[model samples]
Target: MISLTSPVETRAHHWRAGIKLGALCASTLILFFIQNWLFQSAFLALVIVLYLLPGWRFFTHGLKPIKMLWPFIVLVGAWHWWSNELQQGAIIILRLLSMVALANLVTMTTRLSDMIEVVRFLTRPFAKMGFNTRALEIAMALVIRMTPVLIGKGQKLTWAWKARSHRRSGWRILLPFTVLALDDADHVAEALRARGGLTNND
Candidate 1:
């Protein structure tokens, strides 16, 4: 497995990868706006081509996360199907799938350090608006670090519930995860403050 902890070199590499991913996303959205069947077909075909080509890295993660998100995906698909005309529904679903694939590509290829730098630079221009770039950076870092842990915790909670054959719904799974997430976030915030990660004075 490639080490996700290691950093990538240069801002330009980040920009290039981001641009490629963004362009694909933008084009798909544009196609959806036109709401034409031909454009949807073409975009879907291109997505298939992109998936088959090596080094795309998005599909390389290999469907597990997509599988995990299937329930939400189906719910959204149903909403689109019922709320729109047939042509519009098809376009909406295709656009959504394309955007999702591109997002996965961005996360798979982009390094954590580069992502942080991009966030820092992107937020620096907003300093004049009284925004604290340091806080934002720390927040992003915490999110990146804690997201996987949170997901793992949720998965464990689900498994435990299933093992007990409980038919509980909604907050039965959510309340504990929310409490655990909050406690974890509080600990992270304390650790960062101890390290002076939130200092305003440079």
Candidate 2:
């Protein structure tokens, strides 16, 4: 799996996963409750500062996945502009950026194993009550691990299209991308089966 954990070490990396996760949850909930653009902007600026405190390399690495949010941001802004609600739009966009960037920061500084362990510990009571925690843990891990892989594959497909055509790849690559994703999923299923993967009765 391609680890999202940043290579440029920072003090945040040493913090406990549970604590960081807890703070992330609280911050996310707080963001949803805020209606003022001024406060939302302030919170987002603080998040940006937090990203910068880790130095240039770490900041850039953390920023990579956050860039994916741009399309959604643009969509939200356009809808709100058409409705003439720029204040609400600013609040929404700022909140979205702040929350996702903060989550990405946590993911980049924390190990996948550590986050998994944190989830496991938190869900122990439910596990004892008959929930299949192992399946959930495996699902979470695979989602985190495969997300970047899919993103990279999409980029490669886009590049391949660009190399062969004069126009932008745009929606034309969707058919091939869908096929590639299905093929990847088939391979992953086979690999999991080889490892004696989860079943409901497990």
Candidate 3:
């Protein structure tokens, strides 16, 4: 579930992880600052085009995690439609989708170990002070890797509830979602233990 890296290679894959991450940050900041729906929509279109450039398999593989964002998309669209603020909603949703898709694009292309190297570089001072920065590095890796996995679980849980009942699942999925996340965490912990990876001590 935590397979953040895609098998399909792109020119983006050959880019340095630090550069990709830096560009992601810059793009996200730009997206956040712009409130124009047209601009946001353009940005999103560019991201989609980037996804498409790697061919269908890579595009589809990259899109799976992005598709998990539909709930928020629905909520934002509905709320905007209800309040007659569709313009504002369009801007919000477009920004949301564009930033997330770009972030996903970076993760899909960049290797996890390369990302860890970036984290290590950023945290060099902590390591030099005799602090166990390995844990911090691993924690960062887990977050980037598991976020999409958990979101996929949430999407499945939502579908399951919708299939069984007539009402909206809303907050009801929280408990089950938490349980599923914890279960995944347990499995991940076991895997890490098996690899002697859970320790912070140097």
- Top candidate on TM-score is 2
In candidate 3, the residue pairs with backbone N, CA or C atoms under 3 Å apart (3 or more residues apart, or in different chains) clash, namely none
- Cα lDDT of model 2 by residue, 1-202, tens digit: 2338889989999999999999999999999987889999899999999989978877788888888888999999999999999889989999988888888888888999999999889988988788878888888888888889999999999999989998999999999989998998899889989887774343
Clashing pairs in 1: none
TM-score per candidate, chains pooled: 0.72, 0.94, 0.80
lDDT of each: 0.62, 0.87, 0.87
Native-to-model Cα distance after best TM-score fit, residue 75 in candidate 3, in Å: 1.2
| Residue-level lDDT tens digits of model 3 in 29-73 | 998888898899888999999999989999889887777679999
| lDDT by residue for model 1 (1-202), tens | 1113312332334455446545755875686577776777787678666554544353444333445556666776788678776666666666666666555445545666666776666776776677777787677666656666787898899888888876864468899999999998788868876888675543
Which candidate gets the maximum lDDT versus the true structure?
Answer: 2
Model 1: residues >4 Å from true position, as ranges?
1-32, 55-62, 80-84, 128-130, 166-171, 200-202
Off by over 4 Å in 3: 1-3, 129-132, 148-177, 190-202
Clashes of each: 0, 0, 0
Pairs clashing within candidate 2: none
Q: Which of 1 and 3 is ahead in lDDT?
A: 3
